[model samples]
Target: MRQVIPLGTVTMTYPGPVREQPLAIELHNTLYAADGEPLDGLADERGLRAWLGAVRGRLPAQARGADPRRLADVRRLRDAVREVLHAATEQRPPRPSAVRAVNDASRRCPSSPQLGAARGGGMRAAIDHHGADATDIALGAFAVDAIDLVTGARRGALGRCGAPGCVLMFLRDHPRRAWCSPACGNRARQARHYRRTHP
Candidate 1:
């Protein structure tokens, strides 16, 4: 059954537009599902454009899940989540300047208390419990990093997906996550397959 969360009651519901540009223009153009789906519709520049339209309003009046564009938006959000995850997990850690920026971004939130809670534990719980779409995932990663940067959490908890050609962020549960998802993993495998066969 489809669950209906109350307005302003959902976890990790950040304010403002998630993207400033189209998918084609973003540094990470392609996204994959764990099952190796191409995720074609929501990967390129047009995908982001479609997503912005879906999430342009507040909850209660938030984007309609039944809207035809909803699926595309969700897909885009997932990609974004992965990207944010990858960034949050970087090994170098946030520099003081970067930490300052993260703090600035967090402070800009209209709902600071909620943001603070998420930064501490709400986001991680959301990801663990409900799982996350691209948007939610991205927000989760952001929340974690925001806490890390502002509250002085450990720097080593962040990570970048190891998938070649895939650039996204995720928490480092272990030392061996190379790709954002299994699809990227498959892509890597296929590339190897082609190289070995062709050579």
Candidate 2:
């Protein structure tokens, strides 16, 4: 059941951000699909600030207060994290550029980097980051989590939503869980029902 809302000239095609998972997954979900086209939840400064506020508990004070204007850098990190995780899920190598982005952001702080086997079998960075620059520290924190998630035990738990036209990631913490959310589960079921009836 889709409902249209009156929003003058512009309208949203996708559902709002579903952020009940790990920080890295949350970041990857910031860019979701809408009406078959990719949409970015953090497309603007306000969106970035709002997302930062939503995840404040997981971030440092400095990161929480990061200037929203640095969204470009934030998006770069998101892209890197997204690519790295997707590559992990496929058991393939992520591009060198993505690895560099994760590493460069991690180096924003002083830390002892731990080497972990990346999903594709290459050693990658796993950092216990220390705080530094106002906003960069937040980037560091996010990068650190992405590293840990893709290389840590939870790596096996990472999953992409199975619903059609949905581009969200989640941790399949429970054996029975597959969709990103209950709504997506319903969507998948509805599609299945429609296909069975129509065919």
Candidate 3:
């Protein structure tokens, strides 16, 4: 049976859009499962372009001018990010190649922050890309975010969705957040209930 969750006025399926997570986690979640089959959110050049536009706010690089030819680069970076995150969550060593890939991407195009006094007493900042284009800067920013997420303060909060057949990774933003979303939580509860009654 398919799991359907009705939250107040709207009804949602078992797997829903996994959002509000960090950029790197979102990248890792590009490969997710639906109805027993894996779906790549970045399966094509057009899809990649759309995904980049969706996350433009969080990325240092602008999305509108991204080259369609950079789709392969994004896919490779996402794969490497997923590999490292899997290893981190499992408390094992990641593949050396994965580590190298992330590092290389992080250094692909470096940016420097320029800070100055704001209107009052605070400070304002802007990024200086040093002539690099949008695509390279975006890739480097994504890799840098992955590095910080896996090795920084919130590293302990990295986790995978526990709902059955779900392969999305999420950062533990809430203390009691076990699944990636409310839909997943409801599905898990429904599964447990089914097992208790059917067995």
lDDT of each: 0.39, 0.81, 0.79
Q: Tens digits of per-residue lDDT for model 3 on 95-161?
A: 9999999998878777789998898899999877756677777877778888998899989999899
Best by lDDT: 2
Estimated TM-score for each candidate: 0.38, 0.80, 0.86
The best candidate by TM-score is 3
lDDT of 1 by residue, 1-199 (tens): 1112243443222221232222211213334333444444344433433433333342111112223334444444344433343444543344444444434433433231222255556652212313233343333333344454323454454444566654444444566766545666788889899999999
Model 3 — TM-score against the truth?
0.86
Global CA lDDT computed for model 1: 0.39
Worst 10 residues of 3 by lDDT: 1-10
Residue 122 Cα positional deviation in candidate 1, in Å, after optimal superposition: 19
Instruction: Count clashing residue pairs in model 1.
Output: 19
lDDT of 2: 0.81
With candidate 2 superimposed using the best TM-score fit, by how many Å does residue 20's alpha carbon deviate from the native? 2.3
lDDT of model 3 at position 158:
94
Model 1, residue 31: C-alpha shift (Å): 10
Better by TM-score, candidate 3 or 2: 3
**What is the lDDT for 110 in model 1?**
24
